[model samples]
Target: MKDQQDIVDNPPPGGSTGDPFTISNSLNAAQTVTVWIAKGTRWSDRDQVKAIKVVYADGTARVHGNQTGTSHSFKFDSDERVTSMGIWTGDRVDRIKWETNQNRTFDHGGWGGTEHSEELGNGILLGFSGSADSHELISLGASFREDSD
Candidate 1:
């Protein structure tokens, strides 16, 4: 097993102040990561999570997200990395959480922005961003766990 430790906790922006918010993070190795968005943030009639983009070890990427849900979670293979994520039609996430390399999970609040990011080891960067008309970046403060083999 690998010794997992705190990678990064890129705090969110002050508040949801504009449209097309974005956040990002970097990774040191291929890790199994779960991405989440706070509840009450995604509404069918308003801004909802649009997509999540994951870059694999080979440099390819995949986009995924739920249009109707309080949160969305996905797993990245051991050799893959979650490059970026975002939501639409809504602003402010009650919480943002992620666990990498099956180690301790890291979380943060005030995670609202058109574009946000953090630098990680091995020259990796991760964050999230999105654009919408009826939205303002806001903080998030809830959490959920996701496990995979």
Candidate 2:
């Protein structure tokens, strides 16, 4: 399932209708520094997983994980620079953090600093990344969170 993201203080992105799910919407609509869940379909119905493809109007997506459950949070950010962020949770390992490609490319973990994440429920994780460049602010990694319900 997909819909326009307009919640809380977070408004629509690009001011271009904000209807980003349309195939006609330019892929460029997804270049920003925010994170919003794209909405998932019911599992038994054979729902195709919909992932966040563009940047957000608020801050970005953050994921949290633990034995208790996995959790995800999306909000607005004013001053955070990141290049890549991700959350990895599994039976053996569970971890999350954000980093700057420039920092990692140069062996500087401090470059992008660490992205903060928290677990919401099960193995479902949430996350997001930012960059100095406004257009390239969000860089996230995850094949896609597994259904933790």
Candidate 3:
């Protein structure tokens, strides 16, 4: 759905009442970032599919798909990356996968019918159904885990 007005005004459980779903972070390097959304039973009943949009450090924006439960990736090339991410949905996302370059990866396999939060690595923190503005913080809905090398 192209209309963001309705989603902004009456957001779902974890969404902001008037503000859009926004998460931002500052990164140390230019990296390939990937985000994934998994389809759930709630997706089938709605006419609008949930979407994830990403705003790079350079102010350019990229928009990614309906509730198809797939992975989407983009590149950020700024010294101090200011990456903003948002998810728009009428229900819960089954799973979310986030990876940065090859340095780190955060995976939230699925949601088990509630909100939760988890911390990954020294800088990555995630919150279920919420907002975050740094690598040390994140707010959204998903089961959490971290991987690094």
Q: Which candidate is the best by TM-score?
A: 1
Q: In candidate 2, what residue range of length 10 has the lowest lDDT sum?
A: 6-15
Cα lDDT tens digits for candidate 3, 1-149: 32222121212244233223433323322134445444343444322223445554455443333424455554543322222223333334333444444444444434333332223332222222333221111224321123331
Q: What C-alpha lDDT, on a 0 to 100 scale, does residue 69 get in candidate 1?
A: 35
Q: Whole-model lDDT, candidate 3?
A: 0.34
lDDT of 2 by residue, 1-149 (tens): 32222111111111121112211121112222222222112222211112232333343322221112222333223332335444332111123344432343111111122333432222222222211111111222322122232
Q: Against the hidden true structure, what lDDT does model 1 obtain? A: 0.35
| CA lDDT, every model vs. true structure | 0.35, 0.24, 0.34
| C-alpha TM-scores of all predictions | 0.31, 0.21, 0.27
**Candidate 1 per-residue lDDT over residues 1-149, each given as its tens digit:** 32224334334433445354333323333223233333334443333233334443555453334333333445455444333322212244433444445353444323333433433343233333333233323432111111211
Give the Å shift of residue 123 in candidate 2.
25
TM-score of 3: 0.27
Give candidate 2 misplaced runs (Cα > 4 Å): 1-55, 58-70, 83-86, 89-93, 99-149
User: What lDDT score is found at residue 127 in candidate 1?
Assistant: 35
